[model samples]
Target: MKTDTRPILSALPEILKDRCGAFICCASYEERSRCISGAVKDLPFERVVIFAIADIFSGIEDRALEIKSNFSNKTNSEIVLTKTHEPLFTANVVAKSLRRIMDDGINDIFIDITTFTHELLLILLRQINRFKDRLAKVTCLYTSARSYSIGDPDDRKWLSKGCKEIRSVVGFPGLLVPGRPTCLIVLVGFEHERATRTIVEMDPELLLIGKGIPSVEHLTDESHKAPMEFFHNLVQTMVSSRGSVEPFEFSCREPYQTARTILELVTKKPDFNHIIAPLNTKISTVAVALAAMANQKIQVCYAEPETYNFNGYSEPGDKVSIFDLDWDREL
Candidate 1:
């Protein structure tokens, strides 16, 4: 069945006035930092919260200090440094931090999960939902990069050298109730070979693709027509006999739709156990996290890249758009 999809005006806009603060994930790429800084300048946010892995916080803070005056001294601003690759630990720490923010009476927030790890992103989304009532507004912001890493031949080889079936941070034993039939939903992105290996090993009874929409149209030779298109073609050939491939398109920037897509699938097929692997946009990763938060029965998994070629990943474009995505307003 065909699905309904809409693109937010592709034209980027300046920051809206209502936002009081921004919560952004720090990234290795300068573009991600530039996007957040540009928006904060226009909104002139009073509170700025930056989340970064401990290893990356130095670079993150250096970039923030360039645009935000007295960044470390601002009473309303703080930086959250987290351990790398430990999602559960990130969840426990971030949950408490966000709760404290709620208790402290910061009600309106703008969130940018552009560079967060999948596990960390998911946990943060749950906290947003957990404190939705106390929070007056929540705007999810993302600055789309001009291009993405296809990885160097050497980097690709290292990433695909071996595949393991280790349980993910959200999927360790006793994490969720068992005994239900499982369905795997993989969000297809640029890493084709690794995804192929994962699909074969997992051998999902049902396979669905959360098709990712690129923030920009130009793609390098290594790039697929769309991240999902590449997956669709690959899955069709690989899983033709195993199961039918389902594709759903979602904007890379408006991640709430990704959350809706996951929720819709779970609701439509409540009997099946859901495992979501987001190998695409951090925005979509946030969506996957949102869904997992709503239902603990759902599992969120991350493919551990042996080493990411941070220098090779596409930098963010000069443009950034800010929108008021008050999803709770409808409720």
Candidate 2:
């Protein structure tokens, strides 16, 4: 990708300001409102497609509509997505639609990935990889949350109320042979127990923790990662009984570097089936997806929450992270 990373909107790069074509994003309840609005204000995107997710949770359904209403005027077209059917099916549906648009001369694509679920994003990448050769100048837009409204370290709750299940994301079913043990790699996020639950459910032989490196740009001020720090300590105890727990650092700001780091980490454990849980920033999620897509032996997984903390999820940060797609990678 390019090294021209603009820190904020004020120092807008000529590319984002001049040529943001076909903007696509979810009409999400939380940070999406901030991302879409922010992009519209700073960038001159030619057309926009907003997906209003028809979520099973009533809490998200109503709130997601509010964003749809606000952006409906600015949006070129609005589509609703239903995930109750299946993630594999849903991802292909979106990917095929995007491919069609690409066929119709919409080339310079920009995706605001602020609110897409990890299940949707990872699977969609696998589907899109089928036509990666046709992709050109596809970029991802992500807004950082200033902080999450996490409860006390001793409290029973954190970002989400409960975990519904820890299942393998459909599109990325990595290689699981008969004799090879599994290695579960997690890019840890703000959630206190989802990663813990994911580890317990998978019960893999190796656990790798991908923690975001500290940053001075409002990110290090992200509540000093009190919740996740406490979480890592808890997980260390769990891994002590099983396989070894290895901790690695990744950049929350730069996705390509994070992707390289993940590939390198998984490459060392050649004897195990690699399963990645992307629970960190959207940029890092992009990294995890890229690494897995480039290597089919590497699988990506997600911990689906039973219900999100609607009242106190997060407030959007001022900065945004952008990553250009490297479609030339053989998938």
lDDT at residue 155 of model 2 (Cα atoms): 30
Cα RMSD for predicted model 1: 5.5
Report the alpha-carbon TM-score of model 1 versus the true structure. Answer: 0.74
What tens digits encode model 1's per-residue C-alpha lDDT throughout 1-331?
A: 0111212223323335444554544544445655554545444455666676665334655655554553443566667766655666767778877876776678877766566666566667666777777877676655656555534332232212233343465432213446666677887665555566667766776777656654443221124344446454665566667755676666554555667777788778677777777777666676666566656677776665544545556555544434444435221
Q: Local distance difference test, per candidate?
A: 0.58, 0.68
Per-residue lDDT over 246-275 for candidate 2, one digit per residue giving the tens place of the 0 to 100 score:
888887667667888898988898999999
Best by TM-score: 2
In candidate 1, which residue pairs get closer than 3 Å at backbone N, Cα or C atoms, i.e. clash? Answer: none
Count clashes in each candidate, considering only residues at least 3 apart in sequence or on different chains: 0, 0
Question: In lDDT terms, which candidate is top?
Answer: 2
